[model samples]
Target: MFLYMLIYLAYHGSRWIPRKQRLKFQIVNAVVITLVLVPQFYVIGRSKSSRYCKQPLLNNLSASIAFSFIASGFSVIFTLIEPIPQSLWASYHLFGLLSCGEGLCTTILTLTAKDCVKTTPELYYMSLFQTVASILSTGFFMVRGGLWLTKLNPGTDLSGNNESPAVPH
Candidate 1:
């Protein structure tokens, strides 16, 4: 969820900056994001050392590492493709899809992990909240994309003229 939020913010927040400065900003953002994961890796290592290597704990640790690596790869790819205007939009769209998938998976896991929720009600609620938020944002993006496509290709008449409804001047 944190990863999703970070990606969301980075995607939208970078758009306003001048093109020349974006590369620098992205470099800094990548460094910060990678640095932030250090503590998480440490915590996971400590959990294992403390003999709390339960399935949930291990699953979370693995997911964290996997997500971190995937995010780093995305950062590299985005940096490489930044020069292409269309690539940026495509990246954002792909991220939206990824967020939706993640939300669905998280919701399913939360629903099925009855024991986990019973043991940790707070975590369950937090997971539910993240899932709901992701789904809402993804829905908004889908609707927005549909509207954009419609605007791009408004209906045409048989004469092949654009068929926007007549409007008074």
Candidate 2:
């Protein structure tokens, strides 16, 4: 989402802009990231997220934290561009674009499969999971964004708001 774009500024920003500048891009990004992460960490503390995670808690915690960080990135983007533009930049489609961006890393790795598979066998398999997650996420976003999922069945938002997608008719 737009919240993710705050990071774009942070990473792709100019080397130095100033108090002499008006709404300096770097300062705005720094403030946005700081403000967004504050609430995220607070939520992590209050929620029993770790306790509910699967056993061998360590492994699951890692996944949970990673997801939280991802969400935080999205939230930062959202903060920057809230009252989201109503054109083709709707949530589902934007997330689809983000998901495709996520896949790029694995895509590059995939292109060099033999080297990784031989060099670090476990990582090769692990990257497959990342690739699949990226594809499925993108598919979900696209389906909803393109209205295909809604067209398939009315009153189904896929977020459990209306009749469940699995509900018996």
Candidate 3:
């Protein structure tokens, strides 16, 4: 899906950007998400005279918070259970994929439903932004996780094979 592509693109692009600037990138991501969502909710909410219009934004905010909690919990579990080579980047990617899946499902459900209709570009863009944000956030976290892992276990084989200095995943 398109969300997956954005995650991967962001994930790989992280390599080109300086490590120190990642936090700033994340901040920009947060801002973009907010910018995209507010207008989107307004447009979508206004178009549908249904009572549900006012609720989607609230639902989305709650969902985002819940998603963050769930993603963090899963990441912690993975860090403790999986022999993930101390690469937080992998975790970030894993988390990003899960988040993207959540966003993708949410968008698909919203667009496909006849009961709740979004009749404007504003709403569509807002949905698109959330999807993109989900992907970017995941990508950022994965990259950060990988960087952390590498820092934690430098010169150690995370892949469990002692043959190569670093096991290629």
Q: Give per-candidate clash totals.
A: 0, 5, 10
Lowest-scoring 10 consecutive residues by lDDT in candidate 3? 75-84
Model 1 TM-score, 2 decimals: 0.54
Q: After best superposition, candidate 1 residue 81: deviation in angstroms?
A: 4.2
Instruction: Say which candidate scores most in lDDT.
Output: 1
Q: Put down candidate 1 lDDT per residue, 68-124, tens digits, no spaces.
A: 566666555554555548876686557555655666776676666555544544444
Measured against the true structure, the TM-scores of the candidates, in listed sequence, are 0.54, 0.35, 0.37
Instruction: Pick out the ten consecutive residues of candidate 2 with the lowest summed lDDT.
Output: 52-61
Candidate order by decreasing TM-score:
1, 3, 2
User: How do the residues 21-140 of candidate 2 rate in per-residue lDDT, one tens digit apiece?
Assistant: 535653575576666455444434443423332122223223434543665554444434434466624653465355455466455555556454544444444455555655665555
Residue 61, model 3, lDDT: 42
Tell me how candidate 3 scores on lDDT.
0.51
TM-score: which candidate is best? Answer: 1
Query: Candidate 3 at residue 37, lDDT?
Result: 41
| Model 3 per-residue lDDT tens digits across residues 1-169 | 2333343443444445566666665554455445534554465455443345422543554565565444434433432332335575566556566666677665664455433434333444455566666556666657867978866755556674454356688
- What lDDT does each candidate get? 0.59, 0.47, 0.51
